[model samples]
Target: MTVKDLRIELTSRVVMAQILPFGLLILILFGLAISPDLVVVGDARRPVIEEIAPGLFWLTVLLSALMALGRAFALEADDGNLDALRMAGLDPAGVFLGKALAVTVQLVAVETVLGFGAFVVFGAPVARPGLLAATVLLATVGITLAGTLYAALAAGLRVRDTLVPLLVLPVLAPVLLGATQASRDALFADPGVPGWSWAGLLAVFSLLYLGVGMLAFGPLLEES
Candidate 1:
């Protein structure tokens, strides 16, 4: 089922169509706005990229992921494919997992490009490369899982485009905070401050949503 979902998204290439250009646009806009210009004080100069990089990276990801997630169930609804799946008797949990897996894959790809773009454009060093990678992986899973869940909740609604973000972003406050702080820690923390705790929070959120989605998706899909 996961493979089927992945194939559909990849073959259609619509998910990538939404993620790549929008993600790149964010990176370019932020890069231009921030500019990494030097600030002068007492005959010393410093770039502000470090100050903005963490928030900028996460913000770009949030916006781009939002755009992608809003369309998660839309493909099914728009094409009358949801009925096809229901008729096929596919397990609703499997359907949810499949959709989430496809979204997660798309998000991870977007993040990979955005990560490099942040480092290069913002001049933010990967202070802890391994920790940064782990944070991204865990945070992405949490985000995609929760986003897919909420997107489904808003499915078949005329206002879902607006409602999806409204529903998902508030619930993702912890994810935004955890991922941003963890990314900040990974990119700029003092040598002694531990980053594992934030990554753990992301993991817990991902697992919690995974459980909820597995249990709730069947009922939710039935209703839709």
Candidate 2:
């Protein structure tokens, strides 16, 4: 498929599968932020928002990532749309890119909502907005590629519904650790040497998964 055409098709499905949950995750985070215990307990340390919020933020992001992965191909598989896409000459790489792009957009949306909520509920400083934004982008892109690839592997299988999370989470251990820690520093903690270092790791992850997904997706998506 041409890049433009593939992107359009990918965007349509991604919005359906990825965006809604991302939106909900932020709302959930917002609710959690108001929890007197969560915010108040961390209150004394004068902790940054990351220390205060990264736990919740990462939890929501993790769940939302799984949700996106779970739905990645099932919707298409159910309607026999998967077959149509391949038969229509959709490039496997294009398909992966399009889907990842959509998920990335959703991730960004979640970050936006979370950003607003963080300020409103926690009164977190918006200092280093650029760094914070970069952290969000890194987190979202990593989730998108990792989840998309795993989703491709599990598509149309009975085990897929449960297996996506099981498979993706273990593989994403490093990402979760690095992204969470890095984000915490940028958002809440002092952002020591480890903070900047973690940020670099997040970038490496984005590139790693982007490459892996692009190469592996074509094979994985072929009708078995």
Candidate 3:
């Protein structure tokens, strides 16, 4: 199921044509707004944009993932594919995992592009590569698990395109927060932020949503 969904996503023009460009555009807009050249005349040695690059990077990923989430289920909801899947007697839990994993894969690719943009445009350095990698892995899992679940719930709704952000973004506050904090610590080597602890929070968030999605997806699939 995972491979099937991934193949669909990879083949879709929307994934290649829309999501990546949108993410890069967001990164460029953020760079313009923050003005990488602008620096504070205070004790802080880094420019304001550089200091907040981690948060900006994650925010870009979150917004891009919103589009990816919408696309993930939009395909299934169209052309009676949802009905076909239900009739095929596939395990709902397997379907859920497949879809979530596909979204995660897309997000990881999105993050890599944006990460490079942040590196060059914001001059953000990776002081601790290990912590940054851990944060990215955990946060991506959490975002996709919760997002795929919410996408399933909103699947059959006409307003799902607009409704998904309303439903999932709020629930992802912890992920955005924890990811930003951990990424900042990893990038800057901040002594006070406890990067690993925030990564731990991301792990817990991912696991919590993983169980919820597995148990609830079957019912949601039927209703949608």
lDDT of each: 0.80, 0.69, 0.86
Among these predicted structures, which one has the highest lDDT? 3
Off by over 4 Å in 1: 34-47
Collision count for each candidate, in order: 0, 3, 0
Global CA lDDT computed for model 2: 0.69
- 1 against 3, candidate with superior lDDT: 3
Residue pairs clashing, model 2: 48-188, 49-188, 50-188
Clash pairs for candidate 1: none
Candidate 1 residue-wise lDDT, 132-190, digit = tens: 88999998888889998889888887999999989998999999888988988898777
RMSD of each: 3.1, 3.7, 2.7
Positional deviation of 157 in candidate 2, in angstroms? 2.0
Which 10-residue window in model 3 sums to the lowest lDDT? Answer: 36-45
Q: Rate residue 68 of model 1 by lDDT.
A: 76
Q: Tell me how far the alpha carbon of residue 214 in candidate 2 is from the true structure, in angstroms, after superposition.
A: 1.4
Q: Against the true structure, candidate 1 has what lDDT?
A: 0.80
| Worst lDDT 10-window in candidate 2 | 41-50
